[model samples]
Target: MLNKIKKQGFLNRISSLIIVQVIFVFAALFLIIFNYSTEGSVSKQINEVGKYQTISNEISGYLEDNISSLTTDNLRYEYIEGELASYDEILKAEILTTDKDNKLTPIFSYINSVQSVTNEIPQTYIESIAEHMISEFNKSNLKSQFAPIIYNTNNIINLLPLKNNQKTEAVLVIVSNHDFIISNRSELSYAIFLLFLIATLFSLLTVYLIFNRFKWPLNKLIYGFKKTARGELYELMEPEGDVELRALTSAFNEMSKTLWENSTQLKKSNDELEESNYLLSESRSYFKTLIEQSPDSIVVTNFSGNITFYNDKAGKLFGYKKDEIIEQHIDKFFTQPVMNTINNTDNELNGVELLAKTLDEELIPVYCIASSIEDDKSNDIAFLFIIRDISESKDFQEMMIRVDRYYTRGEMAGDIAHEINNYLAVLSGNLELMPLFMKKGQNEKIVSKLELMRKTVDNIARFANGLMDPNQDEAVFEEADINQLIENVLAFLKPQNRFDGVQINTDLSTDLPLVEFDISQLQQLIINLVYNSAEAMQQIEKEKVINIYTQPGNEGDGTVRVIICDNGPGVQSDKKEILFKKRFTTKRKGHGIGLVTCQKIIEVHSGDIGYEYDEGAKFFFDIPLKQKSKEKISEEEKASTVYGN
Candidate 1:
């Protein structure tokens, strides 16, 4: 069916439209000519009626003038006879008068020839005509006074009134025989129809001429185009048509010639391409081996994120056989968040740490790198993913974090011990004093000693709680006051000997809203930033001053901004860019994870942090008042933080 439809020529399609148009035009012309002929006949009949009306009016005027005369016995017959003789078409004429009883009587009648006539008018018409005669006596309303002209083909009857002094005295009835002639109307109509018929024929002939003029050439061109499409490259002869069609044929022939030449050259190129293909086949094997033996897993996917190819390392990493993994969507093996990232990535992804699930449903941390493989058109045809199982590396990172935390704790160990010893001393003193007071029967002193001892124990517990390792804590988000957290951090740090001469200024906003964050991570972030500042200031001979400021962020943003500025030598311009990168540190003993950890903490909270230099080194960060909903963040990902390179 499709082939049959395709075989239909363009002329066939257009011929239907041409036929419809011609039929419509012919119908319109027929209607116009027919209506004109009809109207002409109607107009001719109306003119005859008007002529009859004039004759009736003359008869009514004559009767009105001589009505008084015609009623007299001396001139009645003579006047009626003479008037009726003037109108040769009037078959009958009567002057009707009403008697005292309102009965109609013809005073005078003239018969031109013997013919049937109706004197029986409707009673209502008689009364209506009488009234109209009085109204139209001097107003040129002659039609109103005349009875409606009764026409039977060419026969007509006219009833008019003869009035005297604005009063209808009598009615004049006339029956006439006249043949209305509309000359040459049928001939004119026939002529019009004949002309239109000739026009239609000429139009169709022109259409046929135009169609034939182009049809043969176009069909030949279409054949050539089909041949070219099938690689036959048939040449077309210049067709006899208009300039455009001839030019099209010439161009087609030239194209066919060029293609034939190109075909010859293409054969040689194909031979070279075959040789190149052999080399490419060898290269493909080499790359395949390299990819298989590569330590990192390699997976290739199409635009749909479905796995198209994967090396043995990838199979091993995911615990999937070739049959199990091939053609599966990335989400089948990757965690949802990782799948989302992969789908959203357009060009390239580098060093993204994500979780992947193995065939046994065990999730392991992995580092991923991906890039789009595009063709010459820069369209992404496939995607290449380099996957590395980072489970062992993640374990090592956690260990290193523990070691870093332990080292930090070791640095604060003296302060913790000093705080504990002070509380212990107070308790010991209270214990001895309480015994002494009890022996002396001093109840108030004994109660005071017990209260003091309770307070000292509480202090010791609070200090110990502050010293707890953040690495061992679960990642739990909660609303906390910025000023309160800062005060707690300062309380622990100020009591330490490392800050003996260092002055830390605080300008925290009193009305700051509580922001959601992981408490342990926040504490760790503040500790790292503050310790780095203090340690940076150690080399400066000037007074070491660190200023911390907190304020509400821009309205409607639901964030609070905190700036920690220190009067130490700010970071060098050259090294500032990498200040927060992994393993980048400005401190001699710094592990470089401090700022990087701080950045990661802020990121997990959906916040932003940056550094700027004015008169001093200023580190500013914005924390959202609320964290992202828990459902969007998985427990494992939230619980883990990448701290090192």
Candidate 2:
């Protein structure tokens, strides 16, 4: 039964249940009303006979009250029957004896022959009397009633017992028409019918409203599910419903979107895989070369530190042939820890570094890792060591140390400059007072020499102040024309010391935009770089030339790019990684802060700098068209404190 109903839609099933509930409730109420009407009708009629009972008691009291007159029993009986007959409601009255005969004698009666159910019974005024219908009432089953009896819909009769001083037992029986229950039942039937109509209407409206509230959200979710099953994408309207329905809706929408995205990605991957299949053999060859041509040499040594097997890269790194180093102790190329780490079973080794001796007797740095495997002999094992050279990494570490030293030096220079400035300021004030105090100050010789001395002091002060001011964070950005800026810097550099002999070339792009930069700091960077290039070229007899190039950045990205290349011997392989590092210079008298300062200046502008060695060494950088934000820091920012004696 449940399965069959489940096949139906939600509205149909719910409506069926609600309808059955309403009908069942109405039927139960109707049965209860019918039971009450059947029994209550008879009991209600019996209680209504209290009016006639009161009349019988009043006549007995009257007989007692007037008995003091010494009236005979005949007089009493006549007065009782005639006085009771005047009442309008009394249909008939009789005195009865409960002897073995159970006899009854009619006294007086006034019955309403008109038999009107809706009219009021005449209790105050007199009612028209007719022959009492005793034969019909006696023939019916109402004779078995012990008290008042209700016959059909309009008839009422009562039996009352009475006593007299003569020791006689008599009963009063009265019959009348009082039919409130039957008439009330008719009106009540109409009220019951109206109540049923209202209840049914309310039940139907409630079912409809509840069903629609559930139906719309359910229908939307069902439609969404169906669309997803068909591999079609659809947008879900924002739900304003119960929590459970919204959760179901959201889950379905998310599932559909995820599946669609997965399908698209899967198709994209398939296409890419198919197209790239043509290069499979090429890729395999490339991967093979990658292993063979690896920069890190592969070497395996036994537990005795003897060379067993190595790739070609190992030979290149150690400067020895495989045969030459076959039985040679690995200690020839590795330090003591290599032997200790390889033999220690408790050691964890993966690329542990050691100092190695090359064929030329050079102490080169190398990283080594070794593992062991058990041999055929019990408790015997062999070790394999993989060694790679890390000379560049060592060079970078040393360069950073030197950079730290530079910061220390700059800090000292600033302090010394500050002291010198104080002295120079006092001297300037003293010198001005000198001319005023001289007696013959206007003499040509004195004036010319004093003026020369003053100029000399001024120049010294400028140099001292310049040293005190490092380009740490005094950022003053302004628009710069790249094409013109490079040219002017080169022209100014052409006459500086050794650079006077070097040729300079420029490949400036005319279409480049004006970029914002710190002018004074960038000028210092250009001068230091060009001068360093010239100093390097002075040693070599080759034609020394410096080439400078400027262009718009790649993809018109609103940046200015610059390249400075030198035709001297390119950077050596050992120093390639640390070429632009701080405080690692080739010049004998160099402070080693030229390239470092250049990097710092570029960083302040939010740019990048790098160097590469090809036919010659080339340094390049790209700066944004405008400084991100201009903020200045003092020279103390770039320096650390120094300990004094």
- lDDT of all predictions: 0.72, 0.62
* Every model's TM-score: 0.41, 0.30
Q: What are the per-residue Cα lDDT tens digits for candidate 2 across 212-264?
A: 65667778777877877787764564553445556677887787778788878
**What TM-score would candidate 1 get against the native?**
0.41
lDDT of 1 by residue, 1-645 (tens): 888446534455457556766775676577665666556666855665586556556655565564554565536457557766777777776667667776566777777755544344454554455445434543664443555354454556666666665556677666676555333557656766776776677577657756775777778788889888998964656655555677788888999989988987898899899999999999998888899999999989888888999889988888999888889987787776454675576567877877788886766668889888899998988888898877456354454445556767877888778877888899988887876798899998888889888888877765654564545734578888878888777877777778878999999899987788877667777877788888878888889999999999989999999889899888889878776653467766766666766666676677998898877788988988988776756554555645322
Q: Global CA lDDT of candidate 1, please?
A: 0.72
List where candidate 2 sits over 4 angstroms from the true fold. 1-298, 311-324, 332-532, 539-551, 554-559, 565-645
Which regions of candidate 1 deviate over 4 angstroms? 1-403, 443-451, 469-474, 634-645
**Winning candidate number (TM-score):** 1
Cα error of candidate 1 at position 271, Å: 5.0
Which 10-residue window in model 2 sums to the lowest lDDT? 124-133
